[model samples]
Target: MNLFRLDASILPGASTSAEIADAAEAEWAAAHPDGTVTRRHIGTGFFPSDAWTLATTAGFTPEADHSPAQREAVALGVALAEELRGADAAILAVPLYNFGVSQHFKIWTDLVIAGGGPATPLLKDTPTLLVTTLGGGYGPGTPREGWDHSTPYLERILADVWGADLTVVKRELTLAATTPGMEDLKDLAEQARTRALDAARAAGRALAGV
Candidate 1:
């Protein structure tokens, strides 16, 4: 089996999201030691900001009129689309930044859409695990209630748009352990992390068909 894993964490070494994803991936690895895994780390290796625009415009412009950059962007978009289409399963680790999806992930999503066509379902019927982390609480009654604009959009894309059998693993209050004002919430954060990691492992096992 082949697994496609994408991570968008600017601080990978200290990323709560990555830690959650690693727990999930470890299960998969244990189950399928011989399986192939494809990885893309957008946070560390950013794509050109204009790649999506160039790719989208290339579709409208004649082939002969396409610039070299546009051509490359188009190829990149197609490659990204193929990566999703070809995967047996997928794990996407995307942390909320500035209260929403990071710019790096947004660009990647746009490029995939541009390449796969706006309505295409690249991950149709595929099992997908989405791991998202937030620095603060966003649940009901919290000060940041409804402030999480990332999870819904992610669900729309992975489950609704891409047609994946999606499993979401979310960890919130990630900053509590380190942020000065959140010392009181550290225990709660640890609890959340433990729960998320457990869920992630279960999801990973499911993905491995174990």
Candidate 2:
């Protein structure tokens, strides 16, 4: 079985988001030691979000092109699409920054899943795992929880565009008022990693018809 892990941790060294992703990946690997694991760290270098112009002929051209980084965007889009095609399952681990997913994650999402036309869902309807971490007071049932844009947005994009059936695990309030006294976020990272790994294993088993 093959699994793709999208690690969007800004602080690769000490990032809770990355740790959570690690949990999922680790479990999956342990269950299926022979399975292939593909990791894409979008935090470091990823596609920049493109604002394609609305051309009169339904096709973009040199004159209609506005973003100076179109070349990079196209290259990144191709790479991302290829990666998606190669994986049977995917795990996206990202932290909520300012009530939304990080720009890195957003940019990647926009590039890979923004194709048009009916046959556009070339990478849709797959099984997906999403792990998101928030700063504080944004746990599951909080009043302001709805303000958290990461979960809702991700779900919509993956389901509607990518056609993915998803399992979402969110670790909230890693550093908040009500959930104070938290010193570090490494444990959270570890836990997330384990969870991701487990998910991968489950997916493998199902694929094997076991």
Candidate 3:
């Protein structure tokens, strides 16, 4: 079995999303001791800002007539798509930034989509686990309810667009402990974090058909 893991956290060591993803990955490692794991840390070395535009433009141009920049962009897209195509399962750890998807993840998704070509779905039916962390509560009845814009957008891209068999494990209130105004919700935040990690472990086990 092969697993491709993408981490989109700027703060790798302090990220709650990364911690949750680690739990899931540990379970997967336990199940398939010999399986290969590929990791992409997009947060640190994010895609170029204009990769999508250049790749899209290249798609319209004949391969023989492409500019050097266009060719590089297209190559990047192809490589990203190949990673997904070659994986049996994938894990994505992303955190909401400014109420939206991380720029790193968005660019990666765009490049992959552009590279997939019109007739092919690189991730068709592939099992994918998405672990996300939000700094504040956005669930129903919360003051910030409906404020989250990242999760739904990610769901659309991974499941609807790429046709992946997807499972999501989410942890909110991640800022409760450290944020000055959220001190009262620290206990609830911890509980949510625990549940999310447990769910991530279960998701990883399921990936091995266990």
TM-scores, all candidates, are 0.98, 0.71, 0.97
Report, for all candidates in order, the number of backbone clashes. Answer: 0, 22, 0
Report RMSD for candidate 3. Answer: 1.1
Question: Any idea what lDDT model 1 has?
Answer: 0.93
Clashes of 1: 0
Query: Given candidate 3, what's the lDDT at residue 67?
Result: 94
Question: What's the true lDDT of residue 33 in model 2?
Answer: 77
Candidate 3 residues 32-99, lDDT tens each?
Answer: 99999989999998688888999999888999999999999999999999999998998999999999
Best by TM-score: 1
lDDT preference between candidates 2 and 3, better one: 3
RMSD of model 1 against the true structure: 0.8
lDDT of 2 at 2: 82
lDDT (C-alpha, whole model) for all candidates: 0.93, 0.65, 0.91
| Candidates arranged by TM-score, highest first | 1, 3, 2
Q: What is the lDDT of residue 14 in candidate 1?
A: 89
Q: Kindly indicate the candidate among 1 and 2 with the higher TM-score.
A: 1
